[model samples]
Target: MKQKNKKNASLAKLTQQLLAIDDSLTGCMRCGLCQAVCPVYGVTLKEADVSRGKIALLENMAYEMLKDADGLSERLDRCLLCGSCQTNCPSGVNTIEIFLHARQLLAEYKGLSGVKKIIFRFILPHPKLMSFFVAVAGRLQRFFRRKANKNMGMFEFPLLRPFAGKRHFQPLAAKTFSAKYGKINTSAAKSGIKIAFFPGCVPDKLFVRVAEASLKVFEKHDVGVFMPDTMVCCGIPNLVSGDYTSFKRLVKINLDLLSQAEFDYLVSPCATCVSSIKENWFRFRKDFTDGERLQIEKIHDKTVDITEFLVDVLNVDFTQSANAGCTRRVTYHDSCHLKKTLGIFAQPRKILKNLSGLEFVEMPEADRCCGSGGSFTLTQHALANKIGQRKRNNAVSVKPDIVAAACPACMLQLMDMLSQNGDNVEVKHVVELYAEQLTVNS
Candidate 1:
């Protein structure tokens, strides 16, 4: 009887902490406006699937409709937390804050799993260890890889079938970008402009050629390059996982690495990393000391997505000289972190639209989320695929020669969906397309 009482007391305490987040959610106004913009709600139609509904469920625990703490954690993980709901909210409910608070509180209560603790708390923050794993995985990729889609540059792991499903993925690259070009410093060819490059982990590890293509464009345009060594993750994976400690650690590490560099701007081929540095870093800079905060602000001010840098800063003319109606038809997928979060839709399209020998076709709902919400896809693969298939259908409807997205993570999900569906569409980064069009000799 005493033990039972103790357990109930603990549950009550957790419930109270979870409910405290509701104070921040008071602005919700019970408005269903979130439903119109929510990607998960649009597909699931479950009340508990939308941000409004998730808030209500958390509210229910305060009122005692839910009692199982574990079940509540499961419910909370269902959301993409893409901030679309908050972006569309008329009352300005701040759904992202509420969800972040709830996730933090719940993660505090449940504690991260053993595997997750090791991955997020340890491996993710350590670049050297991460690079080692990437190298090993790259070497061992062929022994376990299964051919899933030939044209899409994807394969499936028959070994990881139980955990990864039968989903196809791009095979790990034999050499990482960082390994191929270590601490590179390139002088501007003739354009007399320079930028620091950050390819993030996936591109640096799995999509080395994408980074090469970006560098190719930079070289052809006479843009000087500053590629640094010993950079950490951009803190997106950490932030999304509710591990703010690790996230801040990575941010500080990256700031320390780039603090001594000289560059016009810090450009990356990744949309998520750019958005995180430009937006989220400044928002969370309060956690740092004033000196640290100012440094973060300086870095944030200079950060730009690669496409944005090309089209906006460099003023790369995408107007095809004579191949405006080129034979190759391609469609673009707007990454949620890129289009929805950063308002960087037009620049990538302009780069794509200007490509010679390529016909630009707009996929229906091109701005929709590609269901690759970083770690969200790993935890919630079924829902991720359901959402990704919607994106795949939109791409197929256009029947384009290829699908282009700015983020490599989005490329991963799109490859999985397109590969599984037997769709022949290829996936390429926007820079890859632009790089192909450049007259190298010019």
Candidate 2:
């Protein structure tokens, strides 16, 4: 009888948590404005794939439809979490927060899958352990990976086909960024500014050149950098997977590291990393102690995108250079997180336009998502490719020499789309293009 009472109490707690989204979900007028912009709904054409339909599902479940918890979790996973729907919604509904909170509640009630449990819990929080695994995989990958596209630097492996499903991926670096350069806490050289450089996992591991290019720009501007080896994942992946425990652990780890360092700013070349640190960190700030909350607030205040930091803080300029009119046609893609979530749409474009010789062409729907919502690509590859096709079409329509974006994830999706279509147009980070014009030291 006592055990039965305990079980009922647990159920009651889970139900209460699941219903927490009721208030936010109520803001939805069910006018279906979200249907017009939702990437998943665009491809699937199913109501459940759209935000309003999902909200209705959640609302119904709150009232009585509790047996379909698993079904609800699957429907929620269908979303790209691109914030496109929220950006287009007239009601000003906070879809990102609502969906993320809903996912957390669902995970708590239905429990996270076994594989995600191992990854979010054991694999992601420990940087060194994860790095060790990546190092081993990097060493062994060459044996399995065969070149898929020479232009894009993409690879495929027959043996890994079942898991990756013929996906073309950028190979991991022989040596990670941290392995090449140990802790960097230097005094400012030219700009008299100091920063904590948080090179998120993608740039640190797969796209080292992006981080290197960012460093060149920093060196040119005389900025001091503080990149400790102690930094872990930005905790976005953990939150995306609904593993709050791991996310909080990673946040505390980063907070402890940030507190130890003294810098006027925190910068990342990756847009997702910047947005996650500035916005999502603040979103869940209540999870920390008073002291940690203060630390988080400081980190949030200091963090900025690399382009935003360069042009705004250091006063980067190119008009005075010899190659002020240097001639290359380029179009820019506004990474959804940077442009929509953070409202950082203009700064990157301004940097591109001001490039000495680069002509900045505008792509159609410049702010539309490229559909690379982290794990969404891995889970829903076909749909991702379809969305990429649309974005790729818009990019090539301008006939630019290069398609440049601020986010490496966008670059990855662009590479896949362009490579699959056999288009010769190059995909690169905007910072990479800007770095090419900077004077590098011998």
Candidate 3:
């Protein structure tokens, strides 16, 4: 009986923390505008699947009218955290912030699972250990995976299908980007700009070519780089999972590493990483010490997407004469975070347009969510595929030889969708396309 009272008291405390965001919750007019843009709600069409419905649930939960915390957690989990609904919201309610805060509170109320606890707490914070595991997995992957599509570089793991689902994914790289180039520190040359390059987990571990291509572009333009050997996951996965303890640890690890580098700007090929550093890191500023908060603020101000850096900062002249003989049609997919979160749709397209051998074609609904909302793809694979198919169809309709994105996560999703449909279209990062032009011109 005493234990029961203690548990109730704990629940009450969590509920109060959730209620603290009442201003943001009450800002929702319940107009259902989010349904139009929400990818999950678009597929499920369930009121509980959209932001307004979720907001209503949160409101009810705060008022003690909705007692099913498990049900509320499940409903919240359905979200992609794509920022689509928040972007399109009429009331300007901070939906993502509210949902994330609510998730954090709920996760505190009901502790994280064992598997999640292991991955988030134990593995992610240690870059060396994560790399070691990935390296081992890379060596043994052939035993488990069979080629699904040669054209898209996708594989099927029949044995792991029950756990990983019927999906074709890219194989782990033989060597990670960090393994290939342990650490890089170059002096700024002709461009007179130096950037701390953050090749995020997917790019570092899986799409190593994207990271390499970014380096090529940097070298060609003489933009010096400062990539420490210490970078880890950007903590979006942890934070979005409502594991603040792990999130803070990862952030601090990165903060300490980044603070040691001297650079004019911090750049990354991964849009999600850029968004997380630029926007998401500031959300928990109060949790850090005064000095750490200042570092966070400085880092936040300096972080820029690679495309944004190339086009806006470096001001690369894409106006050079186009190679009329070599025209490979390329369409751009605006990553949700790159566009909706960072307003970075135009920069990538501008870079794509300027690439000498590529003809930039705009696909239908170029800014639609690819449904690869970090861990959202893992938890809700079927729903993610449904949302991704729309994006795939739009790209196919444009009939481009290649589809370019500014995000590694989006590239993974695009590769899966294009490969699953047996489409031969190549998926490349915007920087990869730019780097190809740089190679050709040289």
Report, for every candidate in turn, its global Cα lDDT versus the true structure. 0.81, 0.84, 0.88
RMSD to the true structure for each prediction, in A, is 3.8, 2.1, 2.2
Worst 10 residues of 2 by lDDT: 317-326
Model 3 agreement with the true structure over 1-442: per-residue lDDT tens digits: 9999999998787757865866578888788888899889889889989988888777766553247767777778999888998898878988899989988887886788899999999999888898999999999999998999998779988987665567789999998999889989999998889999999999999999999999999998898999988698999999998899899999999989888878999999999999998988988988998989999999998999999998899988887845454578999999989999999888888877776778888999999898888777877888888999999999999899999999999999999999999989899998888887777779
Off by over 4 Å in 1: 1-20, 60-66, 187-192, 320-325, 439-442
Ranking by TM-score: 3, 2, 1
Candidate 2 accuracy as lDDT: 0.84
Worst 10 residues of 3 by lDDT: 60-69
Give the best candidate by TM-score: 3
Assess the local accuracy of residue 440 in candidate 2 as a C-alpha lDDT between 0 and 100: 38
How many backbone collisions does model 1 have?
1
Candidate 3: clashing pairs of residues: none
TM-score for each candidate, following the candidate numbering: 0.91, 0.94, 0.95
Identify the runs in model 2 with alpha carbons over 4 angstroms from their true place.
1-9, 62-65, 321-326, 440-442
TM-score of 1: 0.91
